[model samples]
Target: MFAIERLNKIKELLLAQKRVDVYELSEKFSVTEVTIRRDLDKLEQKGFLVKTYGGAVLNDKLNSLPNASSGDTEQKFVEEKRMIGKIAAQMIEDGEAVFLSAGSTCLEIARNIKGKKITVLTNDLAIGLELKDAPGVKTIVIGGDLIPLSTMLVGGFALQMLKGIYVNKAFLGVKGAQLDSGYTVSHYEEAMILQEVARISSEIIIVADYSKFNVKGFARLGDLTMAKKVITNTQLPNEYKKYYFEQAVKLFTTFDFR
Candidate 1:
């Protein structure tokens, strides 16, 4: 594997498991101990992790904030997320009604949605707050019990509120996206709300970084078939590309821009 890909795997491993052993990673990636140490040093310098005795851990600053905080999650995959957000935002037209889901990736899309005359509906409080001040963009929040971690409304109330409204596009984020488990979320309440959003939208676009792929979460929201398009960073594997394509879901990656 390429050095960049190996480094990303190490990051993902640290994020998922809070800690990683250098020897284990060295064996997994088929790299020498010296090379692994060099990789760890590089990641530490980038502020993505902290070097431990025999491994590395995710930076504490990145872990301290709630997952709902766009500021925190934005630091995880800066460039790739921005590129995906830009492309997803481009798919939206001036007058379209769009639903921005609650997550870091959706927040990025909200940031770039300026100057568009569009009706925006979301269950994400952060997205509402960000777009509330933008002129000519009507923002609607689906009211329900607020979940602080994701800053999203959940429960039957939020689902009931979205019963009849159909959006041109719905941009969603996933905790995990796998071939077997499909799109999943770590929390059950959030999954319920996302399921409703998926059902009501005319087209669903899942905005996720490549790290989300191959991971399985606690709750399964829906399959790739539910989404009309999957927008992610270029690091998505060829296996995923083939799987999504065979499932008839259009997969769009940001590398196309470069």
Candidate 2:
């Protein structure tokens, strides 16, 4: 129980959980909250995490993170996305048609769609591939030209195909979210596709991780009014929880699944 040993163990926990509360860490290590704060300060100085009011969130840049509209999705918030996806995938029921919009978080949902009797439609090439061979799951890739680096198909063909379906549920991944600005994205085409999906769906769900809460994007996708539910990680800021609640947007986090 040397300080060095405790610090290293805290780092390990932060790596796994992505965030750690000072109170929980204090109890876990049989140390005072003051001691845990000092440890967090040490870790923060080492560029491991960014200290919040009561805890530390892992510093993810390409590896500590946020470009607002979009960045390399695969590289950011790996564990957080996995947990968010797990919760979202559970909402999909048997004999339902669900739309999973493009993004790494949606790809995680596609991965967990196994053992379900459902039809999934998506413009995300990665998500389509992930569910390509899933048993009892029918996957339809919206046809169009692929967008560079993003691996998404969007445009006239994608829209034309979207016109024919009545989706029971639609899950979209956004670049950022803010109470004033709503969910936003970097590209107009992405916004168009998302809007069309939302229009044709019975229920709309926005899937994002904790980092997207305060961040703003270039294009607004509409206010929280459009999204009936938003799925994110437990690490989401409290201000956002209040915002979503006020907007009457149901928020589901990783804690629900755990």
Candidate 3:
């Protein structure tokens, strides 16, 4: 495997298992013990993991991505995500068809969607569970391989289902947002599904918090040109504002709670 691919697998293992042994990782990735040690050192420097005598442990820092099962990061930025969700909810009109992407922010947007005579398509199991029984709102859950960490379905089945239908608007979530990279996710499969969703939506709205700005992830979703508008918190840097304007991407900010 390539160096980047190996690094990503190491990250996935660390995130999923919370700890990884150097010898075990060497055998799993088919690399030498020295190479595994080097990988651990690099990951530790990136703040993704902490080195131990025989292995590495996942980091608990707020700036680092939390372990998949921890769910702490989602709860940490709850209010900021809710504010972004409220603004995104306003964009939906009654009786319109909408697609909601998976993420903490988009999950809040699904909850904030009020009395709307609309059909909602989503791969997020959480969003489906929240809006499934709501009166007058039609909810369709896309079926495919389940990503346990994100609790979303993405793969051949989901992509095929999306091909048969289109939406008036789509609300997306990102692991990072850069002027050059557009939006990104931590995994390749998720990025592929997101790109397909963006292609079939009439208007693509990205719901991300200010912390996402300038962050880099493992995979690229698309560039800024793909989004019609980006809804985020007011703390977004002025440099990003200038870049988005130049790229013809409209910027929408929610009220500052801080």
What is candidate 2's lDDT per residue for 11-80, written digit by digit as tens?
7656634667787677567899999999999989988888987788777752333432122433346767
Q: Is candidate 1 or candidate 3 better by lDDT?
A: 1
- Model 3 scores worst on lDDT over the 10 consecutive residues at 62-71
Give every collision pair in model 3.
Answer: none
Better of 1 and 2 by TM-score: 1
> Of the candidates numbered 2 and 3, which has the greater lDDT value?
2
TM-score of each: 0.72, 0.70, 0.72
Encode model 1's per-residue lDDT on 1-258: one tens digit a residue: 999989877776666445666776775677898999999999899887888777777788876746622344435566688788899989999999999988768888988887899999988898999998999899999999986434778888888899878999999998778887788875699898888887888889999889778776667898878887999977898899888888888888887765
Give the per-residue Cα lDDT of candidate 1 at 9: 76
Which sections of candidate 1 miss by over 4 Å?
Answer: 1-76
Q: lDDT values of the candidates?
A: 0.81, 0.81, 0.79
**CA RMSD per model (angstroms):** 7.8, 11.5, 8.0
In model 3, which runs have C-alpha deviations exceeding 4 angstroms?
A: 1-76, 256-258
Candidate 2, residue 34: how far the Cα is off, in Å: 42
